[model samples]
Target: MMVGRDVQFAVDKKPCEVGKPILEVEDLVVPSKVHKNNAVRGVSFNVRAGEIVCVAGIDGNGQSELIYGITGLEKPTSGTIRLEGRDITNAPIRERSKAGMSHIPEDRHKHGLVLDYTLADNMVLQRYWQPEFQNHGFIKKNAVLQYAERLIKQYDVRSGQGPATIARSMSGGNQQKAIIAREVDKDPQLLVAVQPTRGLDVGAIEYIHKQIVAERDKGRAVLLVSLELDEVMNLSDRILVIYEGEIVGEFDPKKTTVEELGLYMAGAKKQGEAKA
Candidate 1:
């Protein structure tokens, strides 16, 4: 005897069509706020459209700093970052956003959302300056609410009070969903996702995974930083193993094993040349 319901498993995903590079980072060095040595040291890579390029490493191995450097959360000490061939190494966060970059930050509270704001407001936090959401410095409340409701429904971001609910009051998973909804709806060409499914339940994880894959299939360039080995293997088109702020190895997910990746991630192995 087996249990059956009206359900379809969510693991299957359409393959993405990878194209030219959308984001380029060369010789990036980000200093650690807490340590004397740099956090990200001479790191470099590129994320092309229609592919998920994952930076796999243990926590505290400069993954956060790499993302920070690329997304303008922290200025790089040296090297250049380019989006669609234009240099944006010193661009502000808002400038990066305007240049087709969307970030799903690791710390949702610290960087992803303003807890005190209503759900509707948070939905357009990055785009409120646009003419559609604002006019002559006044927020178009009705338009904002309508857009938020649309995202909430599409992304399944559940809240007790709908669009009026405070962001901090929502469940952790729902809050993550809301952030993703906001970022994805921006129609970015380069999506920098750091731990996009970090603390969600299985169902939420499945949903988020599908959403990321869907973005890739839409020809978006996805730079994924993750600690989960299974996710790294399952979702990545290519994997770059990081150790002590440097990329130690690059592997095709279909050809590499977890143990092999673990060795590189732990500083036990280093390829002679890890291609970008």
Candidate 2:
């Protein structure tokens, strides 16, 4: 949200600092098949710059579709996806990336990393075709290596062979950190941080959370989609619950009770009072 005057609640009492939303999703619908029924229907919300919006659902309730639709991995059947008031409803993945969007997928190994490539190569995976990493049609080895050194050092990515280490060789936590480092280093306007601390131990989870909030403090919008209820309650400024392909509830972390949210997450009942 961008207009400072639009913030209606006091920060001392509210979870969010209101403004014109950095990310506005309206009537967002995603159907699984070309002619199939909707996987996500009428899902909409606003993620203000410097805000962390979490979608907390158990699983199989269109959480994946919500993320995919927003990131251009899947096109919305009907919706307007806006960033900074610009309608980007039909933009391709690359176009979305250039416009400042980053997704840390739920399946990090499958959708995030290139196992065969070295950490350095994979760090620039999404942007390998760009001029900074390319000379003519070849990769600029020095530039990539330099950038990799900076990120690996900055993110504290530990691997047996350091920055030049192969992706498959590093531990899972380190590998995840590499992907995070690469994307976060880009200073994206909106970050789709899907389970940022999924498989990590307590220490790694703490580190990742700090990194996430740090990004928010720098005025970037973060959409955190996670099944871990504790993480959802802890990191999000606002939490949204998706049930049966629709958003059932929205709550401010400071005022809402997670125990009440647990009922909605378990699909026991719909929460109709809180609307995004």
Which candidate has the highest lDDT of all? 1
CA deviation > 4 Å runs, candidate 2: 1-18, 33-35, 271-276
Error of 1 at 101 (Å): 0.4
Candidate 2 lDDT tens digits, 1-276: 432334322222224454557899999989875347798999888999878999998778888888888888888889899988888889998888889898788887888998888999999987888999998999999999998999988999998787678898887788889989988987899999987788886656766787888888788899999988778877888899888788888898778887889888877767656545
Candidate 1 residue-wise lDDT, 1-276, digit = tens: 122333334456666678999999899999999899999999988999999999999999999988998999998899999999999999999999999999999999999999999999999999999999999999999999999999999999999999999999998899999999999999999988999888887777878888899999999999999999989998999999999999989999888899999999888889995555
Error of 2 at 223 (Å): 0.3
Backbone clashes in each candidate structure, one number apiece?
0, 8
Task: Estimate candidate 1's alpha-carbon lDDT, on a 0 to 1 scale.
Answer: 0.92
Model 1 ranges with Cα > 4 A deviation: 1-10, 273-276
Instruction: Return the TM-score for each candidate structure.
Output: 0.95, 0.89
